[model samples]
Target: MPYIKKDFIERLIDRVDIVDVIGARLTLKRSGSSYMCCCPFHNEKTPSFSVSQQKQFYNCFGCHKSGNVLGFIMDYDQLSFPEAVEQLAKEAGVQVEYEESAGHAPEKKEREVDFYDILERAALLFEAELPRHPEALKYLHDRGLSDDTLRRYHVGFAPESWDYLIKNLAGDNQKILKAMTDLGLVNQGQQGKVYDTFRNRVIIPIRDKRGRTIAFGGRVLDNSKPKYINSRESPVYKKGHELFNLDAIRNLRDKNLPYIMITEGYMDVIALEQAGIHNAVASLGTATTPEQMNLLFKQADRIIFCYDGDAAGRNAAWHALNTALPALSDDKQLQFCFLPPEHDPDTLVRSQGAKAMLDYLEHAESLPEYIIATLRNQYNVDDEGGRINCIDRAAEILSLMPDAILTRAAVEKRLADLVGWSQEGLHGSIDDSIEKLRARKAVRGPESTGAGGSGSRMDPNTIPLNPMRAVVARLVKDPELMRAIPEPDKLVAVLREYANDRCQVLLDLMGKIKANPDTTTGALLEKYRDSGKIGDLISLLAARSDAAIEEEGFVEIKIIDLMHYIKAILQEHLTARKQALRIKGRREGGLSNEELIEVQFLETATRQLQPSRKS
Candidate 1:
């Protein structure tokens, strides 16, 4: 990757409106000179995340994550460096110039913006047809959907004619056909003839979180061979990565107490939303993906999966549960609700009303209860062989979960009751599962380390005060200390050059401060408006009640400790570098006499610089 110039990054940061960017994702209320919102990264009742429009940076006093606009985009959207830069540039209305000969040109694809633009146009054309087309209107009305719901979902219709879209768009026939084919709106025959992929079908435009129309799903007006047809995976659309009705629900999230209600079909989502249950979303055509789970995690803390009380729904719930384990933290939760065996969300809301549906959700079976019930129905535990197989299968599934002692204990107790195993025997089985998990983690190696030596494996729930972190924290709290450092430029340079993980975000903020000496904390915080973690970092620093006063205070102690920490870090790097030299010598058909002497000299330098263990 071509190195992104610091000046370009700084310019991009300057151009962005931090409040506008962050306000899009979170609800912000003005507090003095800053804006406060509940930290979106963690479940917090209080507004710990502060956005400083003046500083152009954001920091969560609760969580110590700080960064600028680019950092905010990367964290909030889960975008890469280039993606975040591109997004910020778009937001700032700045066109990024690139040199083709500099090896930095974005790899061009034949189907680029034009494809998505065409799809958007196609969606609009389909949407226009909804009100006029009798079959489409009847299909929705028959499903108990209202005009408000249809418009909210941008429901549309694709006419049955093969050339309806192609001819009306007034583009080259071949190019139009190719665009339709690319979007999976039409099929190209062997002879290069074009035809409609969705005929007399109600179209639902599928958009990403950015609210750009990326794909479409069509449902036939009548009983058809294929019940629904969705756009194929293109440069833009991945069905598993998206959830239907997300665009609609996201709009209403601020006013309502957002709770994710997962239904089985697109119409089910529409029906529920029509009934004033606006916090509902659905899977595309298949089971939920981890990507979908992450998206849900962003909007709401509590997720209730409302599926039909049938075998298939139960199986889907199980799959969704497994997919969510890695992503779901203690703060985030998953609940399960099943409608009557024959009734879907649409039928339930229509028959019992929205109030009854909400009541059912509140009283629905817990995930564990649903899992146990599903297992018992699938396998007869009274049969000895069946019981053994069930226990083994349950153990395999439970082993996949991360360390959650209370939840694990509850699951184990339930498993023992179902299998009729003694508590002691079940304890042994749980231990076996834990050991397997540990072995797998060991094989995967340690979590990657950040530039500041903070390991990625460190849980966000537990904030540790290691020496390096203490140094960074002190710098964060007292920007004056930055001036006192002997080689401030070298220190900042090393931090920026080496730290590309979470810690790099901090380095970026520090770099900005160095560039503009007059930059204020409030401005810095606003710049990182999208970084919930940055707000957390600020909260962490601000929450420290003890002040450092010369030699007697926390500041002095931490500063002295930081100096030693820097020495230790340098020693570690030197030792690692020497080891690399030795390995290189062996790889080059054995070291020459001079090379061996030089290796010894390097080792001597490393040993000489090692920090005192007592410090």
Candidate 2:
């Protein structure tokens, strides 16, 4: 591991061009002493996100996300402090000097350097083997990969014979062979014979973020089990700690828009690049870890979790969601998308055009949406007990959420509606259950939040109506009003009904617009042309574009007053819930000493909300 010094970080931050870093991703218009743009952190049509050049700081007035350059990168791009600093330093062409400590002594440096040198030399030898193998060359041509792509990615072929690699390391150097074994590239047999670890496979070199090849991924051309074999973790490469194509992603990071993607395979990422999507990466064969997520988020504004569409794929996505939820932020977006069943991105793009693949991405569901889908897929949502269990599952996962009240409330409401419960009933029930679970966890030890769903997993997610359709429609008509779409909790008050649930695709459209400000209604119509009825609605809206966008008579509702109306209704639900609790207490030997205080608080709160609810 490379140790970064505090002094080095301070100097890097002082000298780096933050404007250049941020401006490269999105267009920033000048606004007096600062730059202004739409806040990428949340849904908005207004330019509330601002950066002060003089102060070298950024703050979104709407979302209230503020920070200096380092903080900005960490929040918006999802990077760590040290990674952000190193990225800046590399751009500035400065050598990063680390402070020496007892842990990082000078004596340990030279041996590590030799390990790196051996890996570099071994990569060169692997590259040389490609031309010598005609079958491997044919495979590359069959994939339609250009020579430039092959060289750019450092594609290679390892021979089928066991001794091929060990035989040709320039001078039969045993010292190099010993180091190769230590790196896990060669194996010593039970009889003490040495042979290559990766043979009869096409080799794909994996590099560290700094652009040095540290490991390899071998794909078998013939029908075989374990189709892909990655390097065993070594001193230079840590398993589940490195991302494939990371070095290439770094080269294109600054120029792309507010997002990048994470795929499950090496070929998927490479295929995406060939199809003009340069901002993507893949995790090492395992599921994404918290450490890897931190590194990935720092590189872009949003992350698309693209995987296969099989049973294994759904389970993988579920695990990714559980691991990611504990760290979920209000503004950091993670989307889940799957390729058509029986096809990976590589084959999918080959058969369909890149636009078809992109359209699927544009139609992908958000993390909350995907979680609901996955949970629902496993349960019988039409049954009463099934619904309770699904919500129980939701509570178990959501209790780990860091600090997102509004977002959590919105999700809980949606979950309740799916199970045919009134929002108030589900809210009270889930809250009681969640508190009980928390107390249990407090007394016991921490349990693992793994691929296990609370009960049998629910069914795949169905589209919940964005009940705020009447409101969302008026906002979508203006497009500009989307900037004021309120926080999620308030937004949920309008979206809790399933009557106009089909309108959600329209609501999801706003996210696309926020990511790409130049997006037009016509573009959206074409993008969702196959989305059935929603497509027809957008088509009609596109046809009367003049009236919806240019004309003066479109209904212009007072959104603030509407939101206040929704807030009042929510408060009434709470008041009713508290009143029920008191009534039940009276029927069952009166309120407890602890319950008395809660009853008092509710009485005061109910009186406060009565006037607002009446409004």
Candidate 3:
């Protein structure tokens, strides 16, 4: 990936009016200097999403999703970091400049912009061609698609001729042809010859949540060896990264869809929509992927994967279940609905009705139920040995649930019942498995000395009650607060008394702020954008600080409190050292002159630190 220059990103953020950027997508009501609305990341009745116009950041009290304009666009629009930057720059009327890095050509960025335009142009051409091809229209109409549904989904037909798109889109422009080739719209053969990638197939354009045409899915008109072919992975499109018709689903006004259904193909999605079931998406011709599951869960809390009841469909559903295991949480859910053996979502909805299909969904098997059924079919729970195997496998699978509290407890209880064991026994077994999994995931790498880089050591004790963490979090959210400290150098010296990785991080951050006084919170975090665990810890602390210090001058008071706390800790250390030396002097008839001098110095420092205790 090409690196966008830090200076350029900071400038783009400064120039962006966050209100205008977010307001264009969501309705914003001003609440003092910040704007408030129901968070787009989660469902809620009351407004908890607060956007600070002064700070140029957003924090949601409900879901706790907070970030600057770049993060908001990335999350709400489902765009990658680079894509978010590009889109924001365009909206801010600024041209994005990248820092030169090895192995990355300058033209790759230009190619990316060209890919979006070319894909969109291809969608338009295909939509225009749909009217010209009666056979394609007949195929769609025979499948019970209404004219409104076809137009709404941008359903089109690729001409049977191999050079149809090549002629219409590229013509004789070699540059456009190469770009189309890169975007998977055209194939370049051995002789540098280019041909249309989709031909004689009905094209259903696949889009992102932003409604940009990123790729296309094409289906054959008759019986063919491969019934469908989608655009290959390109700079703009990843196969498993997007779900078909999600753009429409996100745009729905309700925002309270009971569930989002996942199907296997583009036609299934289109047919289901034509049946008036608007909350369905397809996995773009691949088995459900973890990335797809994340996208689905973001739209709605519950996901119902609708698949055919054949052996292949069951296998696909199983793959989906495994993919969804690690992402399971209390707020998110997964269920499986299998259609009749002779039918898929398309055929089932067409034959019975939308209500019948919905009934099948209403009775979908949950994650635990599906897991237990699969295990039961695989092993005989009636036998003692088989029961033991079932217990072991159940423990392993249940350990993948990430939430170690509520979600884990509920799922564990379900598994325990299936295995006919006490919940305590199953809990111990899953606890062991979770520990082993964590052990396997513990990877070792070179240690980092800087807080703004990956592999930096972050002390676990630096969280929750650490006054130093609160100090760092405050400074991170507002670097200008560094000026409130009386003598920052002396404070750094005091912090160093702790001699831990977190203190080192604070030292590094203080130095950065001292050198760059005008830095904003967004810009400061951008410096540690890739600082792995340490970066995450700092952001978490900063959020806590934001929630705590809302009063005027309270932040300054917090900094002062931390300073006093550190001074007290250092004073206690000095007093302890003086007592230890005095004990040594008593133990050995008399101390050396150097030892006596050290004790005198410690006593003087302790007296100066705590005058109230002085006699």
The per-model lDDT (C-alpha) reads 0.70, 0.67, 0.78
Error of 2 at 422 (Å): 1.4
Best by lDDT, which number?
3
lDDT of 2 by residue, 416-534 (tens): 76888888888888788878888988877655422211111111122222333334333333445555655743444333432124335544766655655443332333345346655
Candidate 2 error regions (>4 Å): 1-112, 161-175, 256-259, 443-615
User: Residue by residue across 436-515, what tens digits does model 3's lDDT show?
Assistant: 76676667643342332111123333457555565677677778778877788876775565344446777788888998
Candidate 3, after superposition: displacement of residue 568 in Å?
Answer: 4.9
Q: Candidate 1: global Cα-lDDT?
A: 0.70
TM-score of 1: 0.75
TM-score of each: 0.75, 0.60, 0.86
lDDT (tens digit, per residue) of candidate 1 on 411-524: 778888999999789879767865776687787775422321111123233667654555555555455455556687776655443333425645665676687766544345
| Ranked by lDDT, top first | 3, 1, 2
Lowest lDDT 10-residue stretch of candidate 3: 449-458
Model 3 misplaced stretches (Cα beyond 4 Å): 17-35, 100-113, 189-193, 403-407, 433-462, 489-502, 545-548, 553-556, 566-607, 611-615
Against the true structure, candidate 3 reaches a TM-score of 0.86
List the candidate 1 regions with Cα displacement exceeding 4 Å.
1-7, 14-36, 50-57, 61-67, 74-87, 98-113, 173-177, 256-258, 383-387, 420-425, 437-482, 487-615
RMSD to the hidden true structure, all candidates:
7.4, 17.6, 4.6
